[model samples]
Target: MSRHAWIDASAGVAGDMLLGALLDAGARLSVVQEAVDAVAGGAVRISEREVRRGGLRAWKADVSALDDQPPARTWREIRTLVTGTAHAVFERLAEAEARVHGVDVAEVHFHEVGALDAIADVVGCCAALEDLGITSVSAGPVAVGSGSVRTRHGVLPVPAPAVTELAKGWQVLAGGDGELATPTGMALLRTWAGVCEPLPPLTLDLVGVGAGGRDPAGRANVVRVLIGTRSSPIASSLAEPAMLLEANIDDLDPRLWPGVLAGLLDLGASDAWLVPILMKKGRPAHTLSVLCPPTLADPLTDRIFRDTSTLGVRRSPRDKTALDRAFVPVKVGTGQITVKIGHRDGVLVQVMPEFEDVAALARSQGRPERVVLQEAVTAARETGLVVGAPMVSVWAGRAER
Candidate 1:
């Protein structure tokens, strides 16, 4: 089973604090150290110690720079040192900085965040996640502090311009005084966390509390991580929040509609389709509709604007209910075709052969597509796979295959 990590950043989140929490949560220190060493080029060392934050015990991770004055690195320079998720995190940071300064991403150079210790924190946290086999990550609403903070660019308001840019789609609050969430922390959260919401249903396994530098008077001043296996799928299947984006276009090339729909799906829209409609001036236009998760609404909306000749796009919230689905392969003559099985309450509800597979089989064997689809369905039934049949039949049929 895959493991999930839920970040409790209600207090705040920092790169060092997040790293400490993962370390406290059973990620091997050696694994984190090795990854940090590789990325930081041996210019930094990280260590963790138990500490008290508002009387709550937590792990405090400290990254110390070995070089007295390490050379300032540019976004391009840092981009070359990291790969995969770590690289993505830095890319987000660079983009945020560019947006804040109104400059090109390649021209942005590191200030405080580009330091060796910050590099260690980001790389170590990423390594710790891989070490713990955390496949998914989610975070709660973040608390970005208030008041003024002095930066290399002079005094700036709390939640720094770069941090604000990175927090585009995330939920945030002004929790307390001073800087609570740093740019590095916001970049990490925006890049790694797939969803920002309250705790979801999960079978609790491990908990780690990571302490921030200051132990303020009231709150714990720490970030908490809860690792666990996700609970029942039924909770996720019913009434999930979704978004519907629609635009009517008559000027775009007719042939581009297919590619526009395909592009939406490629960009993470759950479903994209077109509906024919007549505009006010008797212009026959197509209404492009895209269904996607709420998190993707912004990007998909932008895509609609860029891909089609639409002056306006409309968005509405929707409740989407989905079935529990599975796939099993069945023999269609000499070729094997995959069938989709939908279940509800542990009972089989629908069974259909995947059309793409059926079409491929038809073309390969010089048979009509309809004939191949029929054979695939017949093979499924012959193996005891059908609507209203026990789902156990699916497992048994797989065994035969």
Candidate 2:
């Protein structure tokens, strides 16, 4: 059962445009409307009109713009607005934006996002996500418009400072005129989206096209979102990665080596390994490396630097493109355990037991860890599942000589 969702920004996406898109994608308009009413802090008057984007007719979401607008906020005030909204992943995203901009959350006022309508966009999208029960969200590469537009703060460049700041690491292309991807849009995207990278493997179930406001004339201004099924069992996660953490250390203390390897794994490293290499002056130095998921990358790196003698640590994203992996329950010698198996295409490429489960069973039964480990492996092999042949071609490693 593969499931996935995709956002097509070929026409540029906006807040309201996204809401309309969700509605078109099978989101109950009534449900979305009710949620908007509550979050808008007043009666949210919504109207849907049949519009054409790049010659395709679609429903466009439009909320009445209010005259009694809130004051223009910095990234700080905008964050406070987001905080008062909800505690879902969206809230965390608002907070992250504040941290990125180096401002107090609440004081960060709304720029393009300060208006009541913008709030509608956020709440509407959030409500729709909840309604859809979407576990994963991804986007096609976005084309952030260039040039300038008149904003609450005055006339500013196309990818407004706020938008630019919002889309820090996201993949954005170029655009022709008016504000394409707004700050509110960017914040919503960065907060909930899993990856802006090329679409990963997914089994297609549905295709959704979200209509954007104002067709950019001679181009697609509609934000098209594809709602399909994920082909793998990989889960979505985050890591507070150190964007640029690196230090070339030539210091070596063999007595201090054991702690680095053992401690880092405990501290949450995807992998911690070493390579022998010659230093600048031909001195021997172990190139200690640590690979971690984004969330744990920074702290683990910091731990290595602070706890160890390393002066600094080089850090970057360590994104893992996992296969369609799953764990199956197995019983061995009156003991039951789970084994994780990785599948690519459809063939079983790898299999391993749950380390903690095996260790606990070994400890409880007062049996040697090796014996328990072997039992678990044997059980899995006897009753293990097989993946598709295509998967085997991609992931099955060569047998040992």
Candidate 3:
């Protein structure tokens, strides 16, 4: 099953704190170290130890720079070292810093977030999520804190200017004295977290607590990450509440439909598609349909209005059912491909290779997409993920392709 992680940043959040939380939750330190090493070239080291925050035990992740005088890297230079989620998080930070400093994004230099320790924290966090097989993430309202903090630019008000820029559209508060949320923490949350709400429903698996720099009285100076799995409705008789949002557009450029649909999905829509339709007076157009969890209805509806030529959106309640699904990686020659397995009850119902993974492997090997796909399916079957085989519990360490 796909695993989800809920970040309980109600106390506060920072890069090191979040990393410690993931480590406390059972992410292998070796995996995180390897990923960080790939990005930093041994310029930093990370270690975790038990610590106390308000009498509560938590893990403290410490990242130390191996080189005393690390280069003051620019956003452009830093962009070359990271990929995937870490890259996106830094991109968000760069843009926020640029907006706050009123400079071009490429001209922004690192006095804080660009340091080796920060790079380790970001890369380590991304590696930990992959090691733990967390495919989706969400969090509660962030605590930005109050008072003032000293920085390279000067003393800034609590929350800082860059953090305020990155906090746009997210729920936040001044939960305590001093700076509670750092720019790196806010960027990581905004980039990886799909939604900012209360704890979501899931089968509880593990909980991790990461301590901050201070152990203030009366409150735990820490961040928590809760990892668990949600039962997929696809294979269940019980249906989950959902919403179907539709918009009829005849004036939008036909070429924009892909991006419009993709944007909706990125905004947490469960599914987005278009259907051929003829409106009043026989006008030919497509009906854009977005199916999502009821909680996501508002943001997705607003996105439709912004991305499409639709003036209004129609919403309706829906009961969604789907088969239980899981992902497992199989080797096709030298490349790894993830295959999606669908099951009903406890029996295997279907097995299919994820097309994107197959396509990527094909591109790297300069082979036909269809050829790589066939090889992946054959590899999956050989690995005993065939139809009618009993469904088995697999470790949640397989990262999404």
TM-score to true structure, per model: 0.63, 0.56, 0.63
What is the number of backbone collisions in each predicted candidate, taken in the order shown?
A: 0, 37, 5
Give the candidate number with the greatest lDDT: 3
- Residue pairs in steric clash, candidate 1? none
Q: What's the lDDT for candidate 1?
A: 0.84
lDDT of 3 at 4: 74
Cα error, candidate 3, residue 57 (Å)? 0.6
List model 2 lDDT by residue over 29-55, tens digit each.
777778767656564567776688788
Cα lDDT computed for each candidate against the true fold: 0.84, 0.64, 0.85
Candidate 1 on 1-401: residue-level lDDT in tens?
A: 55678899988899999999999999998898889888877788888899999988999998999988877778988888887667767878888889889888887887777889888888898888878777667789999999999988999999888888888878999999989999988877777665687997788899989889998898899999998875665654577899999888888899898899999999999999999999998999888999999999999999998888899999999998887687888877789988888865335678999999998888988889988888999999986678876443344344221
Order of the predicted models by TM-score, top scorer first = 3, 1, 2
Q: Please identify which of the two predictions, 2 or 3, would achieve the higher TM-score against the true structure.
A: 3
Consecutive 10-residue window with the lowest summed lDDT within model 2: 392-401
